[model samples]
Every structure is written in structure tokens, then in C-alpha cells.
Target: MKTLLRLSFAAIFAALVGCATPQVPVPLDQSFYTADKKTVGLMLEAPKAPGLALEGNIGLLDYAIIAAATSSLTDHIEGQDLGEFLAVAEELSQNLENEGFELVRLQVPEKAPKLAKFKDPDGKDTTYFAAKDHRTLADQYQVDYLLKLTATRAGLARPYYGFIPTDAPRAVFNVHGEMIDMSSNQLLWYSDIAHSAYATGEWDEGPSFPGLTNTYYVVMNKAKQDVLGALAKRESATGTLALNDDEEAEATESSETPAESQQ
Candidate 1:
């Protein structure tokens, strides 16, 4: 009878142990870019989606189940929420335009609603969200290039423990953009940009989940600058400037000055 009771208690304990397991969030893919060399029309695709989950527990395991759980703990593990992505996209578009790229804003299908409601981190009420569908928004904007972006993991870091101190929370982002020839549907150029930053604790309070998302917009903006820099460098190397014919004519004259002088 005692053995039977012990077995039942063990089963209950095992169930509780399973419930106590920690589940770390899955990370998202970084953003990248692609384009056709001839037309220089760019197409950007966001990295694969990221999900919110507990930190450091990538493989969730309960403390009771393991004889000795790893001494390390993660500060905060969470995915980049939708609000963050929208802000990033806006910044990225502006950055591309500033860099002399004609970006077309892709719209979701007309039949579908422009904005959809989603749950925020607080889990209070539904909030509006948007996506880049390409078909609907393309007509409204006159663009030779299209840019798309996805938000991967925003904040990630190891947790602080007596045995192992936690590292700074780093922000990871993946962004891809491509330039395609509108007529030929050929790829001209593309770039895959990824970035990571250590958590300074300034964005959030004590590694809590609330403010982790705030850093996403800032990181994405930085990423835009990075992508722009890359494109600018590529443009400089290829001599396929984004300037109009008038500008090209002037550039040609400028290049002839030394030759004319030598002659």
C-alpha cells in the first residue's frame, strides 16, 4: 500500500515538474536584400519571423526534473512584436529614399483590411497591424524598387546567476532588399543585412520583458543606415549611379577635364 501511494505521489510530482519547465523563445531570421544589376530596382525581404518566449530556456526544462539545472539564467527572452516591425519599416523606407532609391510601398490586398488587431505584450486589448503584400500598394506609389522587411529577435541575452553572470542583452535583426528590373523581372542587386547589440539596461528595467520591444525600432533604424551604406558603396564601385541623365552628363564632363588637360 505504501509503495502504491509513493508511486501516485511520484506521478503528481512529475506532472508539476513538467508545468514548471521554462520555455525560451525562438529567434527570428535576419533581413536581407536582392536586386538586378541592369535596372537597379531593389526588392527587400524581411528575415524569417521571430517568436516571444522565455530567455535562456531555448530548450525548456523544469528545475525539478534535472538533477542540477544549469546555473545560468537568461535576463529576458522575447520576440519582436508587430508594433516594433511597423516602426522599423517606416524608418527603413525613409532611409532608402534618402539614399536616392525609389521605393514602392507594397500594400496588402484591397479585399483585406489595412490593419489587423493583435495582442500586445501586456495582453490587454487588440492593436492594429500591417504587412507588405506588394500587389495593392504598388499602384499608388511610383517606384522603380520595392523594399520589404521582417523583424527577427529583438532582445536576447543570458540571465544573471550567482555562478554565471549574464551578458548584455543583444538585439538581432535580419533585413533583405532586392532591386529588380520591372520589365524583365530580373534581379539586379540584393543585400542581406544583420545586426546585433548588447543590452545596456537603459531600454528596459532589469531585463524585464516590457521594454525589450522598445529597442527594436532603434535597432531597425540603425540597420537601415547600414543597408544604405552598403548600397552606396556598391553604387560607387559599379559606377551605376542613381543620378538622372543630366547628372550623368555633368559627371562625364567632369571626368574629361584631366584628359583634355593632358591632350
Candidate 2:
């Protein structure tokens, strides 16, 4: 009887181990190019604006604000909330500056009033006030172009039991951005980029968190680069044609027509 019991326990352990799955690795796909290849004004959206919604959440700014407020004082993630949208905007602005592009700073007002309360996991109400101040800042800065970006998770799977704490079959992120011509109130450019990464284990508070994964940055940078690149490409193409036209005109003048030569 004792031997049989031991055998059963061993079999169960083996089965659980066999069922474990390996974590999936994330991928990065990034590119930048211009369509017109011309120099144009580039302005970054205000970080304070409640933009870039994720999973029905208020937006990146709201998330950052919440994260900063809730984080332990000693934690690195703590402090004033800049939100994801603003963080990305700042990064892109720096990148554009480094590349020698003309950058315009715009201050667009927030469309929605700051929320007075938020739903916590424990069904408690959490009050927020910083958002109100940020909204005011957005209104003060009148920007020429508004760049709106949104991030959403399409799917999440349960974790496997054995080797790893979690194993998602697939994780998808939909990233999209729109360039709004504030003057015309029209969308001048819009594009969406989707990418998938495998989650090997349950996400923990660390560098490996899905949010920290470079995949998000890859998609965002590509989107930004795409806008600037198109403008740059257009300019390059136009300049080349202009130069060629000038050369041809000079050649024609040098080879005077017979009637003009006779004179």
C-alpha cells in the first residue's frame, strides 16, 4: 500500500512538470521613412493631456498619475505622473531634435474634465486632483498639430502550471497614432502597427513587465519616424528634381540656338 501511494504521487508530479510551458519572448519591429521627404514643422503633444487610452483606462497620463500616487515612496516608479503618452511624446521630441528637425511646441487643452474618483481593485474610491491641473496646462499651450496615440491589448491567455508560472499562447498589442492638422481639424496622417510577444510566466513588478517591454517603444518610434521620414523623403525628392532642372537650363543656355548664335 505504501509503495503504491508513493508511485501515484510521483506520477502526478511528473504530469505537472510535463504540462509546464516556456515563456514567450517579445519581438521588436521598428522602421522610419518619409513619404514626401520634406522639412516640415513637428510639434509634440502635451504630456499632461489625458491621451492614449489603454483597456478603457483614462489614458497614459492617468495611469502614470495613479502609479506615482500609489507607489511606495522608495520605489523608482514613484513621483509625479507623466503618463505613457507624455513619456513617449518627450522621447520622440528628443529624437526629432537630435535629427535636426524643426520642432514646434503646442499646448492643446484637454477635452474632458478631470475625474474626481477612480475605481480601485478593492471596490474603493480613489480621488485624483493632479489631472485637473494638467488639463489646465494643456489648454494654455496652443499647438499647431495634435498627435494622438492609443494602445490596446487584444488577447490574454491563462498561465501554464508546470515549468513556468504563466504561459500565454499569444499576446497582441495594437498601436495606432493620428496626426491632426489643428488648423483644418482634419487627420493628415494615420497608421496602425500590431505586434505579438509571448509571455513565459506571470508578470511581476520588474523590468520584464509587459509594459516595460521595448516592443511598445519599437512600435511607437516607428510610427513617429514614419511621419518625419515621409516628410524628409518628399523634400529630398523635390530638391533632387530642382537641381536637375537647374543643370538642364544651364546646359541649354550654354548650347545657344543657331538663330541666337547668328546674332
Query: Number of the top candidate by lDDT?
Result: 1
Clashes of 2: 19
Give each model's clash number: 42, 19
Off by over 4 Å in 1: 1-103, 108-145, 157-168, 201-204, 207-218, 231-263
Cα lDDT over the full model 2: 0.36
Worst 10 residues of 1 by lDDT: 23-32
State the lDDT of candidate 1 residue by residue for 10-112, as single tens digits: 5466568877533222111111123332112233334333422123322122322221332111223323443444554555455455544444456533374
Off by over 4 Å in 2: 1-87, 98-140, 154-167, 199-263
Tens digit per residue, CA lDDT, model 2, 1-263: 23223333554665688775422221111112232222223333432211111122133234344334323321322122324434555555655454444445443335654534322234243211111122232333344444555542222222323222233233333445555443333345555545444444553435334432333333333343333332232234354221236545854764483211000
TM-score of 1: 0.39
